[model samples]
Target: MKAYLDIETSSDGRITVVGMYRPSKDLKQLVLPNITSQEILDFLNDAEAIVTYNGDRFDLPVIYKHLGLDLMGCFKSLDLMYDCWEHNLYGGLKKVEKKLGIHRDLPDMNGYDAVKLWSKYETRSDRKALEVLLKYNEEDVLNLCILEELLKAKKVED
Candidate 1:
C-alpha cells in the first residue's frame, strides 16, 4: 500500500497536526498532544511507500523530533519536490498545483496561514481555526496522492 503524508507545525517547531491519505481509505488528521506515536506507526505499518512533497527534509524530521519515530531510512519514500526538480519543474507545492491545474477549496491558504490558525487556536481556544487547519492539511495530503499519480504516469511516458 502507498500513503501520502503531510504535517503542519507551529513557529517553534511544535507539530500541531499530521495528515495521511490512502486510496480508498478515509483521510486522517492527528491533532497533536492528543496523538500517540504508536497510532501513527500503526497507520504506516502496511504502507510500502509514502509520498510527500518535501517530506524528506521537513515532515519526516518533524515527526521524529516530536514523536520519537525515525522513519527517514526505514520506509521507502518518494519526495515529489525532488522528483519535480529532476523533471525540471520548479516552485513549491502550491505553485506546482496551479501549474498542473490542481484545484483546492482553500486555495489561498499556505504554511504561514497554518501557523496563524494554530496560534488562533492556542491563544483564543478557537476550535474553528483548528478545523480549518485540519481541512487545509487534509487537502495537502490528498494532493500528494494526486501528484504521485501524475508523477508516476509521467515516468511511464518517459
Candidate 2:
C-alpha cells in the first residue's frame, strides 16, 4: 500500500499538522501538540511506500527535524519531484500540477499561506483557518496520489 504524506510547519520549523492519505481510508490530519509522535509512526508503519512531492528534500527532513524519527529506509519512497527531474521535467508541485492539468480547490494556496493560516490559528484560536489549512494539506496529498498514478501509467506505456 502507498501512503501519500504532506506536512505544514510554522516559520520556526515546528510542525503544525501532518496529513496522510491511504487507499480506502479517510484522509487523516494529525494536529501537532495534540497528537503524539508514536501515533504518527503507527499510521506510517502500515504503508509499504510513501509518496510525496519534493519529500526527500523538504517533507522528510522537516518530519525528522520535528519528530526525531529518521525515516530513511523505513519504507520505500516515491518522490515524484525527483522523478520529474530525472525525466527533465522542471518546476515545483503547483507548476507541475498545472502542466498535468491536475486541478486544486485553492489554486492560490501555497506553503506561505499554510504558515499564515497556522499563525492565525495560533494567535486567535481560529478554527476556520486550521480547517482551511487541513483542506489544503488534504489536497496536496491527494494530488500526489494522482501524480503517482499518472507516472505509473506512463511507465507502463513506455
Candidate 3:
C-alpha cells in the first residue's frame, strides 16, 4: 500500500510517465496517455499513501490541473522535500547521501535540467530531452525508498 510515485511531464500538459514503485521488485514505469486527464486520475485513484520529493508543491498540482480534480482526498501524502527541510535537513540529494552515509552517486540532472532538455528538444526535434526526463524521473522514484528509510530511522532516533 506504500506507493512511491513520480511523474515526468511536458510544459504543454502531456505526461510522459507515471512511475510507480513496489518494494518487492524494481520500480515499474508506466507511460501515461498524452494529456489525458482521466487516465492519469485512474492510475492514482487507489493508493493508500503517495510519497514524493517536493511533490506537494510541484508534481501533484501539475497532475491535478490536468485532471480537473482535487487530490486532497483520503490518502495520506508525505512530501520528502518539505519533511527534510522542516527537520533542517539541507543539502541537495547529494548532500543527503553524504550525511546519511548512503554510497550511491546519483545523476546530477534534476527537474530543472529536464526543463532545459525539453527546451533543447523543442528547438531541434531531438529526443534526448525525453531520454533525460525518463532517466531522471526513474531516479527520483527509486530514491524514494532510500529517503523513507532515512526518515523512519531519524524518527526512531528521536
Give per-residue CA lDDT, model 3, range 54-126, as digits (tens): 7787667876776655554545887887767766788666566567765543356655676666567666867
Clashing pairs in 3: none
lDDT of 2: 0.85
Q: What is the lDDT of residue 54 in candidate 1?
A: 88
- What do the candidate models score in CA lDDT, each in turn? 0.86, 0.85, 0.68
Model 1 regions lying over 4 Å from their true place:
none
Q: How would you order the candidates by TM-score, starting with the best?
A: 1, 2, 3
Pick the winner on lDDT between candidates 1 and 3. Answer: 1
Which 10 consecutive positions of candidate 1 have the poorest summed lDDT?
A: 20-29
TM-score of each: 0.94, 0.93, 0.74
lDDT of 2 by residue, 1-158 (tens): 88888888998888898898888675888997865668777888778888889998998888887777766568788889987776556898888888878899998899999999999999999999999999999989899988887777777876
TM-score of 3: 0.74
TM-score of model 2 vs. true structure: 0.93
Residue 108 in candidate 1, Cα distance off native in Å: 1.2
